[model samples]
Target: MLSNTIGETKTARNFFGIHLSLSSDMLRFDIYKEDGEVFEDLAYRALKIAVMATKRKQIRNLPGYYKGVLRKLIDETYFKDMFMYFDVPLGDFYFPENYEPS
Candidate 1:
């Protein structure tokens, strides 16, 4: 019964004689429960489920676009920073990878 909204809007003017606008809305769920030592484990499982669900939906709706965007994010310099900040290894994300793809 968790609910939240994430939205972002971007606008660009005079980009090749076109006004570009991009906006997105994502509804996310956050689980609330008693705090304890196992909280981290529960939170991690919840996040794993959420990300898998979103990736499935995106691929179903726009496979090509999703793949391209995912590839770009994977290739970005700051991609590993996300996991590093949380002290989690990149291999822990979904399928484990022996080596990062270029």
Candidate 2:
């Protein structure tokens, strides 16, 4: 199964924020927002189960699940408003890129 490359730890201010460890065998995943034992592992477990089920069913698109999790964990309205600002045509703001898409 895929290992280290699939596992990632996000940190901020020298403190671990969230850890997303993915296992290839069954789409198993672990998310640790902080250190120590967790009393609420169900959320992570549920996500793992969903991912496993989706993979077994030959489903590829999982953005909806990601979006749902993000929306629920963050301020959806505020994030959407912030995202809209970034959706403007790039040509209106930045110069041409030095690198071209293959």
Candidate 3:
């Protein structure tokens, strides 16, 4: 349902990307609604899961990480129904790889 990426100053608003930063404490976690995209509850839930997934993996990163993830997900699965992104637990739009904390 979620995967990849990191943090430094210990703040989370909901988001990530690739290049999991494993050395910073400040991270970015803000997601944006697409053009004409109606962000629903499930969508937010999916984001929540994704964020938790990142934390579980202990992934870290700088700004733009959320944007990067969004871009990658769009390339992977541009949802026919925007809420569909939340259909199967952040369905299809997933982090390319999973990172397990060490």
Candidate 4:
């Protein structure tokens, strides 16, 4: 059986603590409860940054390495303003959130 669970928890797929789902791929995302809308704006922005990094080859496919590079970029970009608000995609893994914050 092809298990599609995101993690061991029931609410693991919630994006930014909101509830929603990607119909085409079965991927879930968070929604804004106040307006019952998904967080498209921030998600879109984050995805764009990710794509740009891929184009520059600033990230590698190796495990852990890409995350390390991402953290560095986040640092350089002063993205700390929102780092805690975005969830790293599963395919790319994730950077250690505890990595010394400046």
List the global CA lDDT of all models.
0.33, 0.38, 0.40, 0.39
Q: What does candidate 1 score on TM?
A: 0.23
- Cα deviation in Å at residue 72, candidate 2? 10
Stretches of candidate 4 exceeding 4 Å from the true structure: 1-32, 35-38, 61-102
Predictions: Cα RMSD each: 17.1, 13.1, 15.2, 15.6
Query: Candidate 1: which stretches are off by over 4 Å?
Result: 1-35, 58-102
**Model 1 alpha-carbon miss at residue 31, Å:** 19
Model 1 lDDT tens row, 1-102 = 121211212111111111111101111213322322233333333334444667566534332343344334323522456545686666566855576667
- In order of appearance, the predictions have TM-scores of 0.23, 0.24, 0.29, 0.27
Q: How far is candidate 2 from the true structure (C-alpha RMSD, Å)?
A: 13.1
- On a 0 to 100 scale, what is the lDDT of residue 73 in model 1? 36
Q: Ranking under TM-score, best-scoring first? A: 3, 4, 2, 1
Q: Which candidate, 2 or 3, has the higher lDDT?
A: 3
Please list all clashing residue pairs in model 1, or write none if there are none: none
Task: Put down candidate 2 lDDT per residue, 19-56, tens digits, no spaces.
Answer: 23211211232432342223124334434554566767
Candidate 3 wrongly placed segments (more than 4 Å): 1-35, 38-46, 79-102
List model 4 lDDT by residue over 1-102, tens digit each. 001322324323333233123221222323323332223433334434544566677664322332343345434443357657767765586569786647
**RMSD value for candidate 3:** 15.2
Per-residue lDDT tens digits for candidate 3, residues 6-84, read: 2432333334222223101112323332422332333344455556667667655523445455444443443456665
Measured by lDDT, the strongest candidate is 3
